[model samples]
Target: MRIVIAGGHGQIALRLERLLAGRGDEVAGIIRKAEQGGDLREVGAEPVVLDLESASVEEVAERLRGADAAVFAAGAGPGSGVTRKDTVDKGAAVLFADAAVRAGVRRFVIVSSMGADPEHRGDEVFDVYLRAKGEADAYVRAQDALDWTILRPGALTDDPGTGLVRLEAHTGRGSVPRDDVAAVLAELVDTPATTGLTLELISGSTPVSVAVRSVAGN
Candidate 1:
């Protein structure tokens, strides 16, 4: 598989890259910083430096061309404010979907948050972030040309992955390791039965492959 990951430098994205590259898949990571390219190369992934926030749809399309699938794992960091939340999280996700359609990349996997809802009500920053994620997931689902799966992981921890998770249509409030989240994304890319499904995930007893297969009914 040729996988292109937006926000290639992100924690989960890097983990996913390593997993894919280790298995001999061609991987490309889209990053905004030139220095980040070396890290991707070290993990056996080609690096494409382009700011998704400013890149046009055609520009992104060109990068996505010849790719088997794309993952939208980009996000404005915690330090970023509300405006960036809308632009990076929501806007970039929509742009990537458009580019995927133009590039004829049919499969897309979105890394979203647990509480994301279009009608969510919270404080200033958190609410904006949720709405951004919610809107982005909605946009991806609306793209009839794309086979999309949305994975909404609960509170993330830096703990090492156990490769075990609770995967369901709704897993309620819980926490999961970021490593496990990346593992799930990698598995989902090859699970065609999971297309068009939105699943919630958290730490649990089921192994990664079993969890994914169970939810996908494979």
Candidate 2:
């Protein structure tokens, strides 16, 4: 399978790239800076640099063409402000989804936060971030051309992955290792049955493959 991931330089995306490439799947990651290319190459993923915040739909679609799947893992870092939350979180997500449609790439996966809600109201940066993610998720869910699966993980931790998780429609709120999250994403990409499902992830007892297969009903 050929997979293209936006926000390719992200911690989770980097982990996912290694997993997919190690499995012999062709992998490409979209990055914002050329310097990040080498990092992607180190993980056996081809890096394509394009700023989602400014790239046009056609430009992005051109990059996505012929890919078996697309993953939206982009985000404005925690240091970013409210405006970027809208632009990167919501706007870029919508653009990427449209590009996937334009390119005829049907399988889409998105990384989202646990408390994300479009109706959420607050003036704080975190609140805005949630709303942005919620709005973007809403857009992806509405697209008919895409077989989209949204993964909303709880608090993300940098600790080592246990390869175990609680994968469900709602897993409440808990922290999961970035490694575990990437493992689940790799599983989700290959599990077509998971299409159209919005799942929650966090550390738990079930093994990664089993957790994913259970949700996918395989």
Best by lDDT: 2
| Each model's lDDT | 0.95, 0.97
Question: How well does candidate 1 score on lDDT at residue 77?
Answer: 76
Where model 1 places Cα greater than 4 Å from the true spot, the runs are none
lDDT of each residue in 1-218, candidate 2, tens digit only? 99999999999999999999999999999999999999999999999999999999999999999999999999998899999999999999999999999999999999998989999999999999999999999999999999999999999999999999999999998999999999999999999899999999999999999999999988
Residue pairs of candidate 2 with colliding backbone atoms: none
Mind giving the per-residue lDDT tens digits that candidate 1 earns over 1-218? 99999999998999999999998999999999999999999888999999999999999999999999999999997889999999998999999999999999999999999989978887699899999999999999999999999999999999999999999999989999999999999999988789999999999999999999998887
Going through the candidates in the order shown, the clash numbers are: 0, 0
Compute each candidate's TM-score over C-alphas: 0.98, 0.99
Candidate 2: segments with Cα more than 4 A from true spot = none
TM-score of 1: 0.98
